[model samples]
Target: MKILHTSDWHLGATFEGIGREEDHKFFLNWLIPFLKEQEIVVLIIAGDLFDQTQPSAEAQRIYYQFLLSVSQKTDVKKVIIVGGNHDSPTRLDAPAELLKLLDVFIVGGISVDGKDFSRYLCSLKNEQNAVELVVAAVPFIHEYRLGVRTSMHNESEIHSLFKEKIQNFYFDLADAAEQIAQDAPIIATGHMACRGSELDDAPQEIHMIGTMGGLPSAIFDSRYSYIALGHIHRAYRVDQSNAYYSGSPIPLSIKESNYPRYVQLISYEKGSKAKTVQKIEVPVLRKILEVKSNLEQIHSILLNISWQTPMPPILAISVQVNSYHSGLDLELKNILKNKFQDASPIIAYIRQIPAKSDNNVLASKEAFSLKELTPEQVFLKMCDTYNEIVDENLLQAFRSLLNEENI
Candidate 1:
């Protein structure tokens, strides 16, 4: 059977502050047509359908509309929606029965040990092939739901407890798969990380924390036909066909700059030993571009970039300017406004300059200038400035009063 594997839609997400409603709409518009053309039967949205646990009303309406549209437009038999860290399981799974009537299966917020999960072996006839598959759907496991106590001291201890609890769930899932699939094939689906072939760019110094990390590959055995994973935002395979993460539908962060956002079309044909696999890329609305250059070069680069296309609302625009550019601070803002305009979706514009010479001078051409700070730092500084301007005298008086009391 032909299945479209996609995840991390992060609907209602904005690039910086710019809205992604258009991007989401564009995806839905193209997706319906694509599914029809491909003659896809199952569409597996692995997880993070929404960017936040509590989505906005408009986001909810649009999300439901997209689901309904797909159900109406395609010959799709099942749309499996799992839960990721960003989704509230209760919220996504609320209208389960109603959605089932529409042929959409919302499987978010599932617990590993929870009874009455409604997961099982199912069969469908596609061209009389009698596609038999057992589904073991696992949602993003929150520690609180799993009954794992956490008065732990450090990352390692916390991770240890998490692993122990989650592994039991995996074993239970395996047992279920073995029992249900019988001679039929089994496919495991989860919104958790499973040590995919790609390495996360997260620092080595860091330890697995809460839902941010994933289980190792060893935990996922070959008993199942394949394992479909989500959470990580890049399309990657753990080994080859056995396990894979269908990255986010749109580029969510600047770190995902190089990876092309896509969905995978997986076709499974039963083999003597293993299931034959085919992976095809389903193109999305936005293409992420990363350009590095100085202010002068950037001006030229922006002009060269075609903003007319539906660029991703989430942009990580980085600018590397000379530290001593007298007008760079002011020019950068003007350039972003003029070139990007209000229509452009530039979420962040990062400016980095070479470290200044320790020799401080008013006009040494390389003096420490503008007091280098991050965007967050800049905001804090502005707040500090406003506070000083408004309450400087009052703060001094309070300090003096405290000093007198101490004396």
Candidate 2:
């Protein structure tokens, strides 16, 4: 069976506050051709179908349009999509019966017993082979939904409780997979960071743990043919070849600038134990670029890289300017948006100030003066000013990280 594993679509997502509708459309255009070339029978999108729980009307329109376009372009027999934290499980799965008519299975949210949606079965055909595959859809399950009741008295106990809860989830998932498969080659799809996989620094971590269960090492063993995971933005392998994450097609944020964005193509033979996986980078509407430059240097770089008509919304442009250059925020934002026809550019500017000398002006010249404060110190100071309870524990952790980085 030839399948495509991809996740974290985050439809309606904005790059630096600029909508990603055009970029997503471009993805569908490339995706259809790729599927045709590979003759992919199954398309598995693990999760994060949308960037918000309640997507805007425009978001809904684009999402439905993309699905319709996919159905039109490829001979793909089945499309399985789960829900990530950013998605509204109910909304994504609202028209399940309607979508099933179009051969799309959307598993938005799971119930208390780890059963929110039905198992999907699809027949995949290659040149001289045909096989049936069963997919156990496990959407993003939060700790509360696990129905885990824990009353731990200490840190160690809390960790143990968490571990036990995770084990139960995996057990439930395994049981569900077995019941759902009913002898067909089993494939699992969900939105969770397995162990040995780096969690993309997304805002989701601020609220809930992606999933209770870490990577299941033994999942690479018998019965389960493949595990398609989401949550992490960068698609990668975790335990082994059987488990994979097809990363986000577009750069979700500036921090994701370094990762090469791509999707995956998986070719599996039912009778055989091995599978083939390929990564495909979709053509993007606008290229995301990042550069760190000082104030004196950025004007030239901006002019050199500036767009004439259509341009990618700039994000978090790091700049180094003289400390004396006060209040350039409004001017900088105007220059960027006005020229590029974007909303606003994300900024990360730093000022370069010389060390204070002995003769430097002081409120009281009774004590010795200190040299220039580093960027790390500047950040901590700002944090302190903004946050009322900048306590010692968080401060110590931040300091340790700064010291480790030699910042």
Highest-scoring model, TM-score: 2
Give the local distance difference test score of model 2: 0.63
Model 1 earns a TM-score of: 0.73
lDDT of candidate 1? 0.62
Report the number of the highest-lDDT candidate.
Answer: 2
Candidate 2, residue 122: lDDT: 37
| lDDT values for all models | 0.62, 0.63
Question: For candidate 1, lDDT tens digit of each residue in 50-122?
Answer: 8788998878888888787887788888777778777888888889789889777767675454654445233
> Model 1 off-target regions past 4 Å?
112-131, 153-160, 196-214, 239-241, 270-274, 287-293, 306-356, 359-407
Please provide, for model 2 over 27-133, each residue's C-alpha lDDT reduced to its tens digit, 9 standing for 90 to 100.
77788888877888888888888888888888788778767867888878888888887788888778988998778887787764454334433333336654466
- Residue 207 deviation, candidate 2, in Å? 7.6
